[model samples]
Target: MSDRNDNKPQTPWAKNLAIWAMIVLALIVGVSLVSGQNSGSDGTVIAYSDFIEKVDEGAVESVEIQGQELNGNMTNGQAFVTYAPDDPGLVSRLEEKGVTFNAQPAEGRSLMGAILIQMVPLLLLVGIWIFFMRQMQNGAGKGAMGFGKSRAKMLTEKSGRVTFDDVAGIDEAREELQEIVDFLKDPSKFARLGGRIPKGALLVGSPGTGKTLLARAIAGEAEVPFFSISGSDFVEMFVGVGASRVRDMFEQAKKSAPCIIFIDEIDAVGRSRGAGLGGGNDEREQTLNQLLVEMDGFDANEGIIIIAATNRPDVLDPALLRPGRFDRQVVVPRPDIEGREKILEVHMKKVPLAPDVIARTIARGTPGFSGADLANLVNEAALLAARQGKKLVGMAQFEEAKDKVMMGSERKSMVMTEDEKKMTAYHEAGHALVSIYEAASDPIHKATIIPRGRALGMVMRLPERDEYSYHRDKMHANLAVAMGGRVAEEIIFGYDKVSSGASSDIQYATSLARNMVTQWGMSDKVGPVMLTENQQEVFLGQQISQQKNVSESTAQLIDAEVKRIVEGGLARAKEVLTGHEDQLHALAGALLEYETLSGDEIKILLDGGDINRTDGPKPRTIGPATGASAIPKAGTRAGRSDGEPDGAVPEGA
Candidate 1:
């Protein structure tokens, strides 16, 4: 710190003196030009006496005045009043004014002298600036040569700005990497017990799980020199540049000995050997080879650690992950509810958040969201609040932002037909009704027919808080709920064409059902055998596995299981809608009439309440009424809209 201040050099006095001298010289030249002008003659007029002298007498023309000027023929020594043809000289017809002019070749130094004089100061300034530039650039050039140096970042001590406190979700993975951080901080302690540092660690997960952020924390904690580079950075256009960079990086790491190097998206250079070998000389493959060689060559005692991150770790070269190179693989998966709350707190630091906004609730609403998404959610929430001209991010804004991110901005202007609005309302209500009656189903968090994203309607639900793993009952329940919308459309509207809005829901449900039969132990015909190996989807920080588990006979059974799951749900939806046929017709008519209905308004119609009572749904209740206006308000009214009161379910089954 002392040297930082003391190193400030005293600027050369001669440089300052030279600059001041130039400024003074310019002022002197300017003053001389102004003083040399004529006295008593108005400066406004342009009287070209020299031009008048040069012109032939035959070419003379009488002066003509323009723009309030009184111009006379040029009279040289006296008033010969000689006029030049080019001038079309000042007119004598105009009203006389005090304007007069005597142009004297815009007097100053001669052309050569002015240019020479001006060049003196400019040359001095340019010379001084270039002198400094070369001095700085030369120093910079020396550092540039070091580009071949290793870009592996470091994290030594556990005393970094981010600790386990800053991390959320994927607890198992976090705990595992924490130990590595501890080992680096005290290698001697581990060595005393014959425990040694692994040469490298690979982090494999889906995108947005904060893999890179964790690496940064490691660097901060280790308090060691950290070199950060992309796996892509190791590659170059030249045939051997990749390998050369790899060698230079390792050499630098050897010098810094106790440092850390982080290579993100290692799959870029670490793809399977011979996978893309057009020849053995491909730049990416060469980089991977050099990396493998260096990792194997570097001794454990050298104290240099390599950490690489990739979302597509499955495609990486196996040699890079083998024992000699990356000894451990850490998986950073999506945050759970608790993890999400912690992450929310971390990201909410600068947001002016409402005291009542609940992070846990928001987290529950957002399943499968990565740290990056949560961060984005928080930012979107802030923006939402700002749009409302609010100082703090409120719960409503958070919910709105969540909807915007998950779905899309409200298409308030996308007008729907009367029949379309009613269809959407019943379609959405059907999902809520089936889920409510199903014993194995999760509680509905939100159910709306509001058109959002690509959906004309939607319903968000939550599973039992304690369910860590999936079950047969839950899976069946999900399938039923997913089919509820289509079933509602058919049961009420009759074998009518279904909208493609439920395409995603069906796809998700189908995948889950397939997994249940083919992979998870929930299947009746197939046992718990893995159908596919775990593949790392790096961006999400999760392990995605596939299955080839079922035999041909069992494959038929699996398809049956999937269809059975979907049909059961659809049948349940049909049964519910048919049971309340009168109410269904009334609600649909109301939806057609209103063109939009909020959850409360729809509930009122179902509850057979008064139409004038427009109070929205109670906070605790969720149903077709919840946020229903998002649809009905958007179209031409052509059907009945029944605003009914809320009601409880019948006594028992």
Candidate 2:
């Protein structure tokens, strides 16, 4: 199937070859006729005077005159020709010279030869057109013959470059897939115990989590044929084309039993049917229906395993996820600390790195990095090293790579005015100070005035450990942190003088505060009821917007509650900044001087001594809590609030 010519419609090579042969034959015959005419023509044209002079000298041996033309052999055995003059004594003159002259009619081109000469090129052109037309028809693989063919690329064991060793991170997912590989290796072992192998396994994960790599590993480990395709490959604009292709792919898979059929991004075709603004595509629906029937119809022990990957598993059709279809669901979640370390190690093998670079430390700093992200980090670090003419990638390069991956590439070319630069420094300084005083907030990692990504300046925080959930107090602290920049601007320069650098901060702060009241049930007026639908669509993998079910009065109350939470966070931030007015100015001054500051540097200057090695806040507990029990009372230590000793929402850096 990999041979391109195999998919092309068979052309009548014999007939085309015959036509080309005929064209060549005609060309050869035409050339032969032209050659015959040239070879049989009078040897050379001579002047009539020269002809007479030759005759007078008896240099001409024999001559033949035909109408106005003359031909003869000279005494020296050289042949020549000349136009006969209007002399009536020409024949007598020749006879006197014993030239052996005779009257002969000039031969013209043969009727068949003239026809062949004129028509050969035309025939050749027609033959070429026919030949190309046949090739075009075959090359396109269209018309009736191609509609049902599978678009899958078949890979053999030899073609598999990635084995299980090449895949790292998401160990649980790999373990699940290893079962499928084992089944392919020895189907009889399971059969003896009455254990039927799963007909299909579905890999659910965000992009770049190595789902496809795991698929390749399965094929390589099992040493079997692999049929790989994408979900979109099954569908076409034409109705029934997708269904036809589904059937054809399965047919091909049956021939290569004990094989794996991997479909990347299955959600493209497997999306929930009959949903969305406009009606779903008929062709895609038909393709999905055919797929359902095929999976249901196949025997579980057939040694043909189908594996599919998609990030949007929430939006998939329920029928596709049934037990008989994709019996095993492998969740390829983002790697944790240990997993990230392993993934980094795998990627670091190919890169020349300084001995001081520690994968574990890097992994600890990167909380949610997937395998692909780690690989990219390694590559970016290598690129940075090469740019600096360094022989090996160092820790500094890795740090820069991580910053680039998280924030964005540095925009050194971007020109910033003096006013903008000062504002940005003060703005980042505000965030840093707030994060430090707010017990619920994560520790300040680094604050920078240098432009990176879209931000004019940024204040980054790093959690001591991975944080999986956020509580009410932490949510409030985050809201305050987001608004800190604006509050600082308001404090330094009056409200009217504040710049627009806090636009993004205000937006995020408003969202967080609103979610606290509406979704987290932290508002006192709205009670503990869930008011909004935050549920995500299974197939589309997006949050579905649900209308508010509360009454108008209740809606007003919700709005007021949201505003109150935001105001509380804002008030707390303003208080913290106002009390530490001197500290804010000092931090801003340091940022302006350094253009960047590490967490320890900021802490050292704030503490007015060496950096304090203090313990971080306690981890925020998970699960939903009822009522406004944890809501802090007004003026409760500014940012800490009056809740559990460490009731702040924890966040991953």
Assess each prediction's global lDDT (C-alpha) against the native: 0.61, 0.73
TM-score of each: 0.64, 0.72
lDDT of 2: 0.73
| TM-score attained by model 2 | 0.72
Judging by TM-score against the true structure, name the best candidate: 2
| lDDT by residue (tens digit), candidate 1, 29-81 | 55554443322233234445543432334223333333233234433422222
For candidate 2, the 10 contiguous residues with the lowest summed lDDT are 623-632
Question: What are the candidates' C-alpha RMSDs?
Answer: 12.9, 10.1
lDDT of 1 at 242: 73
Error of 1 at 504 (Å): 5.9
Give the CA lDDT, 0 to 100, for residue 71 in model 1: 37
lDDT of 2 by residue, 244-286 (tens): 8888888877776766789999999999999976888999999
